[model samples]
Target: MIVTRDLTKRYGRTTAVREVGLAVREGDRYGLLGPNGSGKTTLIRLLLGLVFATGGDIEVLGLPVPRRVRDVLPSVGALVEGPGMYPHLPGRTNLELFDAAGPGGGRRDRRRRIGEALERVGLAGIDRRPVRAYSLGMRQRLGLAAALLRRPRLLILDEPTNGLDPRGIREIRDLLTELHGEGTTVLLSSHLLTEIEAFCDRVGVMDGGRLVLQDDLATLRAPTGRVVLRTPDADRALALLDGRVEGRDGDRLTVRHRAPDDLNAELVTAGVRVRELAAERRSLEQVVLDATTTTSADRADRAGGDPA
Candidate 1:
């Protein structure tokens, strides 16, 4: 439901987003992940028309941004940066003002919609409390309530759980999952790898202002080519396997190969008794860390020197 071609954004001389191309289909629980300053937020802003793209094109819900933004925005809910609320206003008042500003039909319908949104976010019981007195988690829920006032088909959330505690995070996660079940296409940007892995089917990883990789989580999971075998003849097995032997400890050796049959066959042929064999895959955290690794050159630039 969203597409971008050669999308680039710049702040003065520094590039924020660079020649990035991406597409999110209907019913996609897409996660955009990257380190700080990797253009995740810039890309989100460009999509929402919050900031003009320095270069390239972006379409949301099949309409050009900053052009059909009027038609597109009402159908899209976004919680970028954080919820901006008037401290003096009550929680319900904040949503009422925001809903009234939007394309609502009548006062009664708007109130009903606001109530539903507050209820959805678990703030229905405390709707009249002033926002100034609300906790960070409460404010976040209030922000979510405001975003839902329009009943958006697409939700673009940038760290929706920024200030939330563990319980709050789970609440927000469950809420997002519920929204997804109800057919809302979610495009979220987060730093939490576990959070992304929990709900996102696909992820687009960004580094150095570039869209490095975008694929399904299953496709991106690290290969499980490493197998450990405990054998009586570790030296013989190591030599027999050659470069496939990654590490050895006592009678046990770690072999990096796709198939267990090949290792077993070779060891058995060489008259080595295989006492045990086990397989292991790299963790999801490792896969993401490897993908978004900052090169030494990047570090040098950040250190006020030319790329090393």
Candidate 2:
């Protein structure tokens, strides 16, 4: 439902997005992750037609942006940056205003849609409360409700989990999962890798104004299997492996390698009795940090600076 061809965006002397290409199919729960100033927001804005790209092409829902933004926007809903709401207005009134502005069939239909949107965001009971009285999390949910009023085909959300408590985060996660299951395409952007990992099927990692990696979360995670093993011969095991050990404890060692079963067998064959063995999975934070740090370090090395 979304495609970009050599999408490039420049701000004055600096290029915010450089030759980035992306394709998100229908019903995709895709995450776009990056550090600050990493061009993630720039790419999203380009796709939304909020900002024009200096070079390349962008299409959303099979229609070219800028050219078809007017026609396509009705089918798309986005909560970019943060929630926008009238501080003085009640949450319900906020939805009512949006519903009025939207292309609803009539007043009753608009109210019905508004009610459904508020309920879907889990703000059904307290919509009458003023937005200024609501917490940051509530305002964010209200923003989501407004976006949902149109029953959009594509939902582009940036930092959707910001300011949310654990329970609120879970609710939003469940809501997004349900939306994707119902054939709604979602493009979620956030700096939090854990959130993205939990909900996104595919992810794109951005650094230095370019997309450095894009793949299924399962594939990104498959290569990082490891195991923590404790043994009386921990020193001997590390010596035998020739520095494959990552961490050293009193009598335990963390080994960074795939296929823990094979490694355990090797240890046993080498006559090292394993007292305790537990498999390890790399957290999304670890994977994201590894990718960004590697890229940043490479760039720093090329420029003759400290390696991060």
The residue-by-residue lDDT of candidate 1 on 1-308, one tens digit each, is: 89999999988999999999988989999999988888998999999898999889999999999788988988999888888899989988888888777653357788888889889888879856678998988888888888888778999998888878888789888999999999999998999988998889989988878888888887777557888899888888877888888888899888987788876887788899899986766656876677766443566678988653
Give the lDDT of residue 144 in candidate 2.
93
Worst 10 residues of 1 by lDDT: 291-300
TM, every model: 0.82, 0.84
Model 1 whole-model lDDT (C-alpha atoms): 0.85
Off by over 4 Å in 1: 104-106, 228-245, 248-279, 294-308
| TM-score of model 1 (CA atoms) | 0.82
Residue range with the least summed lDDT across 10 consecutive positions in model 2: 99-108
What are the Cα lDDT values of the candidates?
0.85, 0.86
Clash count, candidate 1:
0
